[model samples]
Target: MEDELEDRVLHQTYLSFMKIVTRLTSSAPHDTPVSYLWKMVRLYFLRSEVAVITLGIILFIMYLQTIEQWSRTLLSRLSQAMSPISSVQRMKFMEGSEADKQSWELKGSLSAAYAIKGRRMHMEDRFIINENINNTGISLFAIFDGHGGEFAANYAKDHLIQNLYNKIVEIDAFKEGKIISTPTKDNAEDKPQEPESNTSVERKISFKKSVSTADDTSKKEVTDPELLAQLSKARPIITREVRPTKPIKNVPVPLSSYLDKGKINFGKLLTDEVLAADRLLVEAAKRSMNVAGTTALLAIMEGNHLIVANVGDSRGVMCDSRGNAIPVSFDHKPQQVREQKRIEAAGGYIAFNGVWRVAGILATSRAMGDYPLKDKKFVIADPDILTFNLNDHKPMFLVLASDGLWDTFSNEEAVKFIKERLDEPDYGAKSLTLQAYYRGSVDNITVLVINFLDNKVASSATQ
Candidate 1:
């Protein structure tokens, strides 16, 4: 009974107070209302000093909340800048556009790929299928498997191809009319640019072409002959070739190129571009709270020539004319002798936990991002580049995929599976992912199959 009576009295008092407040605001002088409000506020809260303390706490919490929200928005904007889908949508806005036509034209060559977020919370893999790049009859297909997040993969997919194309054009490879013909000549010359994955490379490429200094005291110069800045936004830039200080000749041009005496040294092109992209991407990632890394496996088909650049565990295999499987990319594992030695040289170690991992955090030794590891040289982004001429190998089809698919399928097994289903609408890409999922694969699965039966055959006559 006492509680009910107290509640009723409090409610009545509140109603009377509101009426007084409304009346005073409407009729009383402004100064009078201000004084009245101040007195009323003191009268209500003076009974308990705890009320003032509580109000102060509430205001401080609100201030902190505002700051946190503002920071979240800022981080999101930076993340969006890494790979802006809105910009792409704006560029390719119309249907049946040039980009669309080119995409279909490449699809007509019987290339199909599919990605699925299988057994993973978020799908981090990204892939690209582009054809007739710069009207040079060059087609590029790539797969990027992200480990920690998708930012590194997406950034690489957006910038690496453009950078590589600009580098190729910089060399006058197409302007000079160097055709890939039989009895090819690979000058085996040292590239006139900075070394591949030079440790001292500035982690940043300028928006405009500018000279980078190595040491002010020594007066040494480090220049990217290609300018190394190929982002679309950078329009006006200059290019100057400096005599290279380092010579890269240790890794020989691979088996197919040597056997056929391949002409162009695409190795240098892939090396320089991938290394530059990795450095810039690392810088971008370091700014964010989430630092990631990705494996890159890229294939460039120009005329009769095919060049592949690989970093990490993603695999690419081709079916030769004899129906035998030929690997195009090699996986980088921490257990490998060379990789182990490099890790140790950099003051890092690898441990086996179901699989060999660099620093027990990453399974692949070479990847695009993955911060402080890259700083310590415990992990590198240097790619292994290999070249082949389609005329010499006569590939029936090629299969490229992330390690998820390779975990359950071998090179021969994948080639035979695709060969049997070459006529399928998806060129066996969908089926391959499904098969891997069924075969106990636990990671994200992505597969690409390019059938060469319908593609233009490269021969000496065509050249």
Candidate 2:
């Protein structure tokens, strides 16, 4: 009805204007030029009620057209801003000095960690410890040594584990503690296996023998804790070299019987979880996390199974009952053959600047942020995951630390130091961190020690 009325009104107004124009032109021969213009206006434009409706409708139409154009423009801009392909928001550097003067500590009945600024002016290191995940007998521990800034470390400290857990419980089997049984030999292909090598070191559980990876170490098993401690103090001190090898991909080791009261997948889907967490960080690094990067080492202990995922040069080593060190995770350095190949494949290069560095900037070839390199595929956040049955090592405790500690302390030296201080007030975490600082580590120092004594762990807060 309104449309019809509007059309009729416009049509009548058009006919009226033509009629008035024809009349004025014919009648204007008797009037002056100025008077003729006034007569034409009075006949149509100033025609009172009809003229008001016609002018009002025309003005309203103009307003509607303007609003329609504005709405379309706004919608188009919004679509471009929100589209994934068209949008690449960048992170901005913060103002003022973020260089920190800080030292920190975290202590629990079963775990403890310590950190300090060391020789660096800024403290860009972060750590996390969640002794129990939803009371499911699962514990989480991590250390992130950040570079460029603290943003990436902070982001991972806050979100990494949450991301891992969300990925873990996605399946009903894991959620209900009804994970499927281990695959049979006939179907062993269901899980990928490590490339076989005769030199592979397989850990075994025996308190009578301390598991040692050194080829030159004595074969005799030391049962006396006191004697082992005595010999550890007298043993030659050396940094253990990390040789990256293909990770063992299968094992629902029979040790699971005593490790847990309930059956849950033994770190199943953990690799996917680590990859998922890094993927998220990469996106954040590209957008808001800035160009900052961090070395991430996360350890999950469920029952007797200990699974570790690592990136960058941060280190993790487990001490056996006999006080020897067994590495749980290997470092990813640019000089590694595989790492060099990947960098070369991506059209990037590494250089030695005091230490081997990726593109002469980052010391490690793998990290959680470092957008400058991650974007170029020279540095990655993909974790090299390794799993171990704590039962096999007859483990005493685990020491996970940043490269800052590794810079000053070797695997053998650190294991011996911590084993001697495990019963101290800080459980060796604080002592080891101070030791690294005194030994002249140039980077930020962080150390985490987790004790497996009595099969007990705790949920603790960082201080």
Candidate 3:
């Protein structure tokens, strides 16, 4: 019976061991840790969800970085592109218009405009130069517009006013040589008289003296009556017979024909000199091709004189204290009828757009550069200079601006707005620029406002 029990126990233990083996085999295929880890890795990889999630995160980060890099690059490029924006500086003075007549006080403002975008590429625009030399009431103001590029405008801006100043000084020097002379009575009475003393001469002298005395008495009677009557009338009508029967002969000189025949080569030397100067500057500037250009309008107040110079379509408008607008500068464009006619007369043709265009090349009637169109005796770049006399009755303010500002506002509108702002103590060019932007002026806008007041000291004290 004991042996039977041991066998039965051993059988039961064997059955339990089999059941444990079955359970382990169902739960896990392999007993090794490596095999289980390999199974888990295969299942995870097969699902694909974690790998896709990781890849999506990496791509999103890359995209965000790319966007950020692009934004920075674009902003940098835009800023670089606008590197040539112009700057303005101004100076105000305390002086009146006249010296001896100092009833009204004088005040003036001067402004300068400079742009440096493409330093190599010159832009031609308007500029102002004001120089108050001592208290001699000598001042100069000028405007320079560059066409075909900024080089010519800059050259003119630097030199034109100086030349004008020199010319004025030269004129003053020439006027110092006029002298007047007055006649003296002592010099007119120095004369000699003859005396007769011979016997034959004595008889003749007695007769001559009697005749002389009678003639003198008659002359005195005639002179006294005529002088008294002339003085009483206070007006005299003198008539005299004058000879005028000669006809002037006309002689035609064949100077032009002589020049054509090479008899006179004066123009050649002049042309060479001009060409040499022109070439030197062009080569120095590294600008053989006339690719740079600008337009300008400037008004300067020197004492009581208003000088206006224009090179392009930019303009200057003057307004009375009552806000009446007056154009001080003429627009120099080919579209103007008078300018078109002038260009055609100068052996040039106007383009179809009604502008003084050269072979459809330039829009302005006159400009500083455009080497291709510049000819020795035909195409010239002389700007129109005008002058006006400023007086008390015409107390005015001036508006100088770029095309951008003019495009959005009319002369009357600009004057009105400026007049309203003039009362502000700290008003400046920046405020005007902001107003232009607010008015939807998309292009770059610049403005200069000059106020001329009667009471200089009182005006400043009040401010």
Candidate 4:
């Protein structure tokens, strides 16, 4: 009886072990050979509760890590995409119409337009139109094409005019054989002009603003008459009839030196102001931790002089009435001999990814900001200045545009294109920008079209 009871207990224990194996194997997947292997694993682990718990913890940790990495990647991409959109919203007013169809006239001579955004979210370009500067028949128009960011371009548009105006004021005072006044922040606006003749009646110079709307929107001409009138109202008049009781101190410079038409070195003056602007922009960018730069192409039309200044690849072209295309500014590129030499001297290398670029990053050797490359001095902000006496040539109009328009269109081609649509300055610029876009230009485009034929002084130079 004792042997039979011992045998019965052993049989019951074996039955309990078999029942656990059957339950675990029943739940195991068996759809393929791999599933058969899974079944074997389930059987082995079923015998030990600790082994199963260990595997469950390992899988849970892996799943959490995968979720965390995926979340991070998604957020990073989303932030990059949305950041440009917010920037776009902040600059809607500055943007040109869809395809840059909108046109506004500056003074009576220049007609300008901004184009549609290319691949960029924002235009990444800014332009300026200040007519009748400093009681002089001078008009200032500029285009700033930005890269990496728009801060540099916008900053230039806002500040370059004032800086240049101050410089002009100082130079004019020097040319008049007068004592240079202490350069004050607001001197340009307050400085009085010397009398051109001995007339007792002071001549008041004023700019008139006029706006005429046409049936066709493209034909509308917009002028800031109020601004011009205000400038006239602010003109300072000094009584030259009653000489000062105190003897006046005059500059010792020869009268002939001041009388000579070519005495002023405008090119040097322009270069200095452009570099100063770059320094200011670089410092501002550092404070904000923003890395950005811009290509500047500006034109100042004063009397018979047309002064063009450039820092990067944007161009200024003057089309003569004889249909000749005169290049006012040349593109600044990394591969150019002068630029390459400068880059090498500054310990920077030019490499090609799509096109030749400075340090395999920036394409232009000269620009406004690009603070990362500023220390190396490879990418500079100094401008190439060109002075043209508009009277020397039969000037018809001036075309200033970012690289986007020039890359696909040659200088001669652009001149012909504009000449065909010369009747409509706004439409001409817009069409040219669109042409470049359709021709596969992958960058932002901005164009300024100034008609010298409209101004009576310049009309004599026209075809």
Candidate 5:
């Protein structure tokens, strides 16, 4: 039994020794070729992942920097574009106006030309107003072009309509006062007193007057009662003579009647007001350092009457029911022969190859402001106002736009485009302006399209 226990203990010791050898071989570090290849492969993958993460971080930072730079550039461009008309300005008479009582609706759009580089720039400005009073609707459209700088254009855009409003008010006041009669030394004393309120004044006198006169100076020859019997026997040899008649004198009608009869005297009013305003604008322009000036085209539609006032090169186009564009405003520039002749007659010489410049200072013969050239006697700074009554058909659309769009498209072309787009279901004024910008208009383009469609149609179309 002792021998059997010894054999079993020895077998146990041998098995324990073999287990210790196996553990030592497994724990020992090995440098076998296969193990080294596996370690190399694992390290290579880790390095690649770290490299990709580092590259991704770098790209993200670059993207952020690029975005920041791009934002700054865009903001700078916008700022430069708006630099010219940054000054504070006010309109002359936009306040205290009654809203339109009519049911008509008005809509408009505007755009700037393409971006320009450096000091030279192109810009546009526009204004529109709709007024309804006593169920009568009035719409006003205006465009202004800034030369030398956009300050003048902006000023005109903000104020020209107000000036027209003031002029209209003046006209209303004149009509209310019955001041149509020419002031004479004798009638001056008999003139009616000014009424406290405009509406309280007496109705204006009839423009026409009738004249009647009678005189009993002479009669046909007649024989006396005693001689009548003798004359009858004498074969009635007496003859009768009559004096020649003279024309009766009639009183002249009052001038205001012409205006009251739907004849808008825009020419007279614009002549008076624009000249005065031109003088003021010239003075103000002189005070400014950059010699700012504006080109203006203004239009007013009242009933069938269309009044147009223009200065410089801006334009007003009228589209009839047939979709034909009619130019209402005349462009005033040095290149016009009549303007050139006027300039030459006034002792002003044309420079730059007969461009009709005033002392070689200005390119336009007629403009609102250019104090440097104002001293020239021949320079026409006053606006030309033209008025006409439309045929029974109302205007389909009236376009008031800056020169940016006009430079590329003629009045007819613009009207045609607007008309064609009008029929499209999704057409919009803003979209048309954007398309203009896309069509190579490199300046600030502003367009005001007045559609006289019904409210429901306009609302639906806009939607």
Candidate 6:
């Protein structure tokens, strides 16, 4: 009975399979692709479970590959949005230096941010920190804010320190009678001179000519401390290089004497070197076919003296022990009376577009390059120099930043902001820069913070 039942079931199954095959053949006049598909489907069902697992693994891998491609595309787009081809933000840099003779130390950090215009450009700002220049204990720190192009700023960063050092070498040579003539030409007539008026908006600068640029349009500002924290991690502008040194020569007097004698005329030396750099820039621009401009703000600390030289709008502010903000350098705007006189005297007019600009073009009255304007004899390369005796007023730190930072934070406000973060010297400049960006500054931003509070000269006032 069992055998008969099994035979009947097998016969019924065979009949059902034949009916399916017959229907498939009758539905198509000729063998169609669908018939092959149906045969494959039937084969698939007849296959073992291992085949099904294999197919599932293949599908999973394909899905993963698709997801990976999508992620790469997303990352590529994000990177492009962060900066333009020419202006990618560089990593932050931090270094430390101590004065040779004074009981003070300097800590410096630099970082760059993209401009609001959103082009692929480099950080047009550059800086230098020589811990022990020629091991003289004289530390040099500077920031160059470039506009129109990065050439000027980069050039200044690479050459400015060496130029200043060369000037000092000449001074030493002159003192020792190794060279009869000064390293710089005694071309007082050719150099710019300060007006006798002490009330000039900024100090009377030397070697200036007329020029013009547009000022920034005011915008609603915001603040971003978080952004600043992130910027602090960027790589430095340039790797620290061995500072070029002038070979030690016979000295008629101690090195200190040469630096301090007759106020050492160090201020003049600085001015001369600055003008020399500008000339070099002009010549370089002529060759490159790219005329660019940059603002320079420099601080030189030798023993008890802190000297500052600035061109254009970048600023250097010193915070005293009492937390008072001291303007070591001033912004050179065409709208200022002294700057205006100089600009007009050079045959440049200050036109007002969104803000006061030089000849309806540049906003700054002084810059290192701008050869086209320089050719017109309207824009000039000159700097304002100020000297402070750190012995008298105990200092806490120094802030050197481009106009992007000054556009948002005031002298006092910035000093106060830094004062609150005295514990983290490196973060001082980073925080200020972030604040400027959050405040909606459209220009590229760069900041250098040098903390004096942590030096051996910690003042009771700030403490």
Candidate of highest TM-score: 4
lDDT per residue (tens digit) for residues 1-463 in model 3: 9999999999999999999999988997555898788888888865689788978999999888657745774797687556664432111111221111111111243332221111112223334434342222334433444444345544444333333333233222222322111111111111111212221211111100000101111111212232223223322211111223233232322223213342222223223222332333332233333233345454544456566656566667777756788777776667677766676776666555343354455566654443434432123444566666666437446667665566677888877776676654422344455566556765445455555656332232233
Instruction: Predict model 1's lDDT versus the native.
Output: 0.66
lDDT of candidate 1 over 1-463, digit per residue (tens): 9999999999999999999999988995556678888888889866577698888899999888657745774796687677556776745543424211211111434477777767765566677776544344556788888776566776677677555544443333323334221221222321222212322222212121101111121122222122123211122211112212333343423223322233446676678668867876766555553356789999988777788999999999999999999999999999999999999988788877578877666789999976556767788999998888788888898898999899999999999998888878878887788788768888888887777875553421133
Model 5 / residue 111 / CA error / Å:
15
Candidate 4 lDDT over 6-124, as tens digits, reads 99999999999999999999998668998877888889866678687988899999888657745774797687667756766735633433334232333344565645556654456
In model 5, which runs have C-alpha deviations exceeding 4 angstroms?
1-126, 133-136, 158-160, 173-264, 288-290, 352-361, 392-394, 423-428, 452-463
Q: Please, what is the whole-model Cα lDDT of each candidate in the order they appear?
A: 0.66, 0.66, 0.44, 0.66, 0.52, 0.61
Candidate 3, RMSD to the unseen true structure = 30.6
Query: Candidate 4 — worst ten consecutive residues by lDDT sum?
Result: 209-218
Q: What TM-score, over all chains together, does every model reach?
A: 0.58, 0.58, 0.46, 0.60, 0.52, 0.57
Model 5: per-residue Cα lDDT over 1-463, one tens digit each: 9999999999999999999999999998878889888898779855878879979999999888657745775797687566654433212111212121101123422111111111123232434443331112344555666565544554454334444453454345455553433321111121222333434334222211101010110121111242223223323221111122342333332335335454446666556545655655554444443345567777666655677888877777778877778888877767678888887787666566334444454556777654444545545767787786665445666666666667678888888887776644322344455556656776556566655444321332233
Report the C-alpha displacement of residue 255, candidate 3, in angstroms: 30
Candidate 1 local Cα displacement, residue 412, angstroms:
1.2
Candidate 4, TM-score vs. the true structure?
0.60
TM-score of 5: 0.52
Error of 3 at 302 (Å): 3.6
Which RMSD does model 2 reach against the true structure?
Answer: 27.6
Higher-TM-score candidate of 2 and 4: 4
Counted clashes in each candidate structure:
0, 2, 14, 1, 9, 30
